[model samples]
Target chain A: MTKKNSEAWKKKYEESGLRDADFSSISGRLLEPLYTWEDLAGSDPETRLGWPGDYPYTRGVHPSMYRGKLWTMRQFAGMGTPDQTNERYRFLLDKGQTGLSVAFDNPTLYGLDSDHPLAAGEVGKTGVAVDTLADMERLFAGIPLDRVSTSMTINAPAAWIFAMFLANAENHGIPFARLQGTLQNDILKEYIAQKEWIFPPEPHLRLITDLMVFCRDHVPQWNTISISGYHIREAGSTAAQELAFTLADGFCYVEHALKAGMDIDEFAPRLSFFFNSHLDFFEEIAKLRAARRIWARHMKKRYKAKSPRSWLCRFHVQTAGCSLTAQQPEINVVRTALEALAGVLGGCQSLHTNSMDEALALPSEKAVEIALRTQQINAFESGVATVIDPLGGSYYVERLTRDLEEEAERYFKRIDALGGVVRAIEQGFFQREITRAAYEYQMGLSRRKKILVGVNEFVNTGRRLEIPVLEIDESIERDQIRRLAEIKERRDNQAVRGRLEALRKAAAGSENLIPPLLEAARVHAALGEISEALVKVFGEYREQPFY
Target chain B: MAEQRIKVIIAKPGLDGHDRGAKVVARALVEAGMEVVYLGLQQTPESIVRAAVEEDADVVGISILSGAHMTHFRRIKELMDGQGLGDRLLTGGGIIPTKDQAKLKEIGVEKVFGPGDDLQEIIDYIRHWRAAQAR
Candidate 1:
């Protein structure tokens, strides 16, 4: 045998008495004693890890990130009727929440009002129901339009929901450019995990692009879309799968925008991301850093985005809802804190921490406050923000970051081979991956390979533990229906019909639907009208039923 | 007969998109060796009942976290009574308190399961109830 081959084999044998080929999770991953020049041999770590507020911002997007402005602590809060939900909104703001993330009721989500036949018994249950401008006004009663940035978590009828917010803000006399925040306007991930989509992909992508163009030209400060990975993770995926699939989805959207005769720089800068803070500590942190670096390189080299903002990957994070356990519910607070820290260390611009009582129901006021406070404690007490990418130079972290990026890039090739993400989704690639990952997680727990503190391992008291679960006021249904009845009675039915007619015409044309929906919203046209108008142009998307 | 398998249609009858619990219960029911059909998120009472009638399922199980469980369950029960399904066992599970559980039963729901409920126990209850219906 050659002398060089003999020496390599001898070294590996001495280390573990086995070949170095028998590792899975962290192998092609470089583990270092300390990340030095030797660790970054083939890669220019500095050019890749550029300064905050510079081109290819792998460090962060802003120069004085938290030192200038602490990350926006936007808690995901909603439930019941608009009035009740509005009260919660005011409460959250009073407690120092900088932004608003509204969760819509099931009826509102499905484009039905409280009194709709299909909406029976379901209104104001999952989230606040807003049938018309009246409920939207009640939802933002005391809150000023020009001040707090609002993020609406709607997908199927996102354009309508966004139009409602815009109409409300305009009525409040706030101009368009003054608005800030995001709409989960991401319809692609709907096909992946959430399953709340209204129209099919072609029309849905058109709707998403419509918002992007409208927001780019009009609502400059507003984020048009937040390409989401949080739902993908919550639906059951490993940290790596979540990272890969989410970035893949983002890439697909970028490509779609480019194909639509739109410049990448025009829409790409305003595009943001949403990720989940799962329980895996360092792994989650590495995933975020890798996301930024990979996105930066891809945007600059592939898409030719000249602006640094276009390259910088900024995201909002919510703690993993699936991580919370129904058993020993109080432990969720500790879990949320750890995941929030992961988000911060990973450099999220805005974050929503899940409540301890979330496994039970929509968070009660106190439960939500605890959730917001988890972020507060992490920001103030933890001192994690004192240093930029505090875990950036760590040997294990860098190694894992490279390893995950490589794993994700492999998925990117498979996606490209399948034509693109939309085709891949149609072929059930993502669905299958998430299904397999979910099974693996459950199997791990079943075999005790993974540990859920209070669930599989810890012996808990069989007795019931009491905590306050939020109850939607029973009057909400009657109240919402009454409001809708009042709207139906009060509003100009003919004008609403004409505006909706305009919307239908616009939907058929290659025109943006937001402006027309906003016009419809001005006349207090119900969400149903706006959604059905779009539905007229774009038929509903049906999934291959899993169950 | 080994056992006349109790077939149940488990559904989330509102916009509550959270389905982890519903899915786990569906899996558990299948493991407990019963015929179960799960209608995913955003199902309405009318839609669920239609599915129940179409499937000819004996029991209807609902999982709601959207806090509209009280009103939602009431509508389901009312629909069933209207359709002559008053004999079919209707059950629920979610973040319901004890007070609401009593209220739910008053509205004619057979049982309410909250977090930490034993899937095996629910499976046995279904079997026992179905056998009693036969007798």
Candidate 2:
């Protein structure tokens, strides 16, 4: 009966005269014209999907999902000097943003002070520059450290930046136990995709393990690492690759932490994930579902974690920045809404919607407000969050979820054969895969196989959309450098030297680097100085150009 | 005599790690049968200029997405002129704004590409510039 019904539908589909276009998912997965029970053949829903908040959580991580608590609307915002970024943070908080996700400047991300030579043109270009704990203090001035949750997007210098945050909170009289936030301390993805690393993989992993251990004991509420696939997807990976590579990186961290003699349940609960909500709606949804299932199963069966909290795979999602167009940029609002919706339906714990003007420049206040309002409308107006796992039982989504799980398992086996994530990275495996995928996507665009509205298709060659882009003044760099120099002159140079020497000594020994880092932060030691001391012990990493 | 193939040096200046565009454009240049040299990430202006002079390349294309195009382009152009490679074309692409692109042109940057630009258009621009220089 099922076969006969499928045959009849296929006959009608053939005669329907649909447009001759690619009907595949963005990840190039071919989809049938219709899906039915036969698509989910031999797969028991109880074992494959299970209940929400149960073992192998594919429906959703929580029993209540968003019905209990809505996802945090955290817009990643930072620019110019610390004072300026502080004002922006205040503005976001005043405008009802639930959380603060800091976007550090490139120099800061590279562990460079504003006065460094390589930091000449990049002082405050991409995000805010925090040269020292003084800068961090000013960045969070007037903000309640005990109340609001902050997420810092720094990797290589994560320990240093995070130490500064802890020191600043201490100065504000907030204990480490009361602090709540997350740090993007995922260095594996940095090596694989983001290309922002200061040390080799071994030393980098050591820093991460130290941070994880420190946060687990000192700051129990803090999320030590947000294992990210956002950069992997932004670097031009398919949905399945992003899913597989990200989960593989997460598993590598778990394995490393377990090897460090730490209990699995102790650190696993603090491990969160960040993923890119790209243009593929159902594909992204399926990938997120598969991620939760894979992570839960691994934690329970593979790693032998006893706690249910350790089995939960909570994640944050950001709409794809690569999907925004430079041409009629306002149309990006529509694109972001759909992607953000997919993230919501995929059961993200937090969401960040990309601004329309991001393709041209940093988003202006108006543009950012519109982007945040998109989320507000989705939460308040749209009925998606009212129900848990709205698309859980759909045959198409279920089939896609299983397919993505198998795809990720295959990648896991391949990575294991290559001796794991770091070895695969050194062998240029991930780089080659991403390059091939990026090139293919670009080729598809050039060949007119893919249609990007207002870019490749629906060309607006006759006119241009005039949108306001937030401009960072040239004086921002000068002012930031001046501030750093002033702090250096006023601070006790003797104490700075002593702290940095202690840090260097600790780096050479088997000690947690966070204590020394926090000491240096307390002395107002510059980020560059601390980083240099560590880089002396842990050499630098250089990548071979793969194109 | 066989025509000289256009040689281009594609470099990423500054500390931004968004190299997907740079690598894609570099691969496209190679497929277009041009002699291309790709200088990977964390490149300084001096290093980029030195490579350009050493490669004796006719075109230097940079990709900057960290909003540092103004400082980078100005400094690189200045170094290129000071090093006596002023006649070579300097072009690039990124998330650069229209006004910044105009200012870049005033500093002798040939063109600045943005998202959604066709690869064929960039290839044609380089070939046409080389043809003009030859004339």
Candidate 3:
């Protein structure tokens, strides 16, 4: 009877003649006019999607999900000097932000001090600059490290920054066991998508494995690596590419750590993922769902992770920065709200909503507040957090979830065929794929296949909307350099020199570099100095520039 | 005689790794039948100007989203002037604000494109500049 009704509806639908439009997801997946039980085929929900908090956690990671506790509202914040960013963090915390996510400036991200020549105009510009433990101290002055969980978006120099963070926490008399935070130390994605790196892949993976082992032994509560697809999507990869590449990187890390002799259950629990919640609502949700299921299956069967914690794939989501338009900037608030909702519906552990004016500048205080409030409204008023996997049983969502998993699986096989993630990265496979996708996306916008509202369609040609852009004071650079100079004058230079020498020795040998790094941070060694020591040993990485 | 295609060099200055805009614009310029050289990422103002002089490019375009555009543009424009490449157009795009765009113009940047701008608009701008220069 259902088949007969579906046939009749299809006949009627053809006769009715739908409007001419690109009826496809933003990722270019064609949409069906209607979905039915037949789309699910012989897949049993009992195995494919068990109960929430159970095996193959497709429904949700936790049984209670957001009912017991809501997702952490962690907004990625930083600008200007450490003191200024501290004020912003204080403001955010006071405004009911649950977690702190640090955004370091490009110089700091590249392991350079604020006073470095390449760091001239970039000092305290895009994000906060921390050159030493003193700067890290000022960055978290009022905020107690023990109380709130922090997430630092530092890769390449993640070890240095994280060591500085630990040194700061130790000065605050906070025990490492009590501290909770995350390091965005996923280096593989940096080479493939973000294009930020210091050392080559082999040495970089070694640093990551060392950190994983260190975190397992010491900072047990801290998430060591946020295997990120956020930048992959931001770099203009399709949703499936993001899913596939991110998981592939995650599995590679697991393989590396396993080879390094760390037990799967020991560090895998703290292995977190970060995804970009793009404009496509259902697609984003399905991607997140499929991510949890795939990770869980691989951890249990393939890797043989004994602990259930190892199988759980916890992730943080940020609203797609690429989706925000410069024209009609106010509409970005609407875009961010919808994207944030997708993150919630898709089961993100933490969320960072991009400010409306981010497409213009970093984001003024006013703009950031509104972005934070958007999450508050969703959590409290929208009633979305009241249920776990609300769209789980829906045929359309399930079909998409299954389809995304299959697509990601196909990519995994391809990546495996190309040796592995690092090898593929060396071969420029990921870069070529992403550049192709990014080019195609632009072509779509130009050809009118994709509509970006104010950009391609809604025509806002009268005058540009003058939203308040957060301007970093020019003097911050001079002030930051002076502060660094002062620290250099005050610090025990002999101790710093000794510590850096030890770090270089450790980097040269197969010894874990974190203990020596932490020792260097304790002596108030400059980030650039320590990085120079390591750079002498590991050497630098220069990309082939595929695009 | 074969008409000369407008020569354009698109480079990303500073440490900002966001290259979606740079790559897209480069591809668009190539698609528009322009002679294009893409200096991928982490380029300094000196390197950009040096490349522009060596290539004898008609236009030197930079894509900067690191909020260091003010310093980069000023330095690149200065270097271009010093290197005797002052006649060439210095144009680029990224997440640049209106006021900064105005400031950049006063400092001799031809034009700064932002989000939602038509690819053809940029293509036309380059073509028109080349045509006017020939006149």
Best by lDDT: 2
**Model 3 / residue A203 / CA error / Å:** 1.0
Q: 2 or 3: which has the higher DockQ?
A: 2
Candidate number that wins on lDDT, 1 or 2:
2
Candidate 2 regions exceeding 4 Å error are: none
Deviation of model 1 at A35, angstroms: 11
Give the Cα lDDT of each candidate. 0.80, 0.93, 0.92
- Candidate 1 vs candidate 3: the TM-score winner is 3
Clashing pairs in 3: none
Residue pairs in collision within model 1: A106-B15
Q: Per-residue lDDT for A181-244 in model 3, tens only?
A: 9999999999988988999999999999999999999999999999999999999999999999
Clashes of 1: 1
DockQ for candidate 1 = 0.36
lDDT of 2 by residue, A247-312 (tens): 999999999999898999999999999999999899999999999999999999999999999999
What TM-score would each prediction reach against the true structure?
0.89, 0.99, 0.99
What CAPRI grade goes to candidate 1?
A: acceptable
Give the Å error, residue A44, model 1: 4.3
TM-score of 2: 0.99
Candidate 2 falls in which docking quality class? high
At residue A41, give the lDDT of candidate 3. Answer: 83
Flag regions of model 3 displaced more than 4 Å. Answer: none
